[model samples]
Target: MGKLGKRTVAAREAFAGKENLTVEEAVSLIKASANAKFDETLEIAMNLGVDPRHADQMVRGVVGLPNGTGKDVRVAVFARGPKADEATAAGADVVGAEDLMEIVQGGKIDFDRCIATPDMMPVVGRLGKVLGPRNLMPNPKVGTVTMDVAEAVKAAKGGEVQFKVEKAGVIHAGIGKISFDDKKLVENVRAFVNAVSKARPSGSKGAYLKKISLSSTMGPGVSINVDNAVAE
Candidate 1:
């Protein structure tokens, strides 16, 4: 076997026997072990008990991280006339109407978040096949579809993160960056957890939050104690 790289070896040793720690402890460990050359995104993955296959059990929502996500979020807006101008004035990276749809149809989706005014749904609806799978489809429930373009764009560019449960009953999102203060990271993690908790569908029966894990982009995951993670 090839010798383990120094960073990899160090990460492994740092994670050994570390599991089911409190949220604060887990975040501290992940932050310390994230010694990558570049600033790494601090990611959180939650194993929930709901099945997305069932319509009523689907878990999806958005949360604004208090400390703001350290990454620059690219936003694409689909609107016409005044709404288009509103989107642009709000710092939207890409704003357009049918032309934007044509670009997306050509498989050239270049933005991370997609937003659309209520009137533009008819146009955006046509691209559901393209955006739905990417989880970039705008939804009013998540504040991505709205008439308030300015606030939506600002929120998207700030630290708002959208999360949807996968087929495996898991939801994952980057809460902050490794460089964030431990207190800020902990606050962001708690905020995200609370949002998911509040979005719990009526169909959920057992323990809603099954597992919580925190990790940096290049580090090993550290399991966080579910109770501590979900506590307000």
Candidate 2:
């Protein structure tokens, strides 16, 4: 491995010997050690006990962070007529039908979130190979595929976050930015954890939430006490 930078080294040293910390403590440590050029995103990772390969064990859900994700979210919507206009008026960065599909297919996916009205699915469906891999497909389960385009667009721009357990049985997402107040970060962390806890799959056995951790874009991670994280 290459030599560690000063910032990385200090962050690692600061997190040394820390484990199973309360949500508040974990957020504080992560925020303090986030000494990067830009405002680093505060991220959370939960190790779930479900094997997603099994349909019954899959875990997926969305949560709107109380403090909002510090990053601005660009939204794309697939709709026509009033729904299309509603999405645009609701601050969607891009809205369209086949025109939007052509843009996405042309390798110009510039949006962070995507929403689609039911009627537009046939057009959006063709881009499954393009959007599915990036987890940007509008799925009904997550409320991205709905007739309520305005609300969906608003939510996407207002800190809504979707999370699905990966093959490794881990759910990861950015909760906020290190620059946010400690209290806001704490609230976002708990809200995210609770959402995941509620999304536990039926086939999940043993301890559903195995572990939780908090970290910054350029900092070392700190494990959080599962009970403390899950506590309301």
Candidate whose lDDT is highest: 1
Off by over 4 Å in 2: none
Question: Per-residue lDDT for 140-161 in model 1, tens only?
Answer: 9999999999999999999999
> What are the clashing pairs of model 1?
none
lDDT of 1 at 94: 96
User: Scored by CA lDDT, what does every candidate get?
Assistant: 0.93, 0.93
Compute each candidate's TM-score over C-alphas: 0.97, 0.98
Q: Which stretches of candidate 1 lie over 4 Å from their true place?
A: none
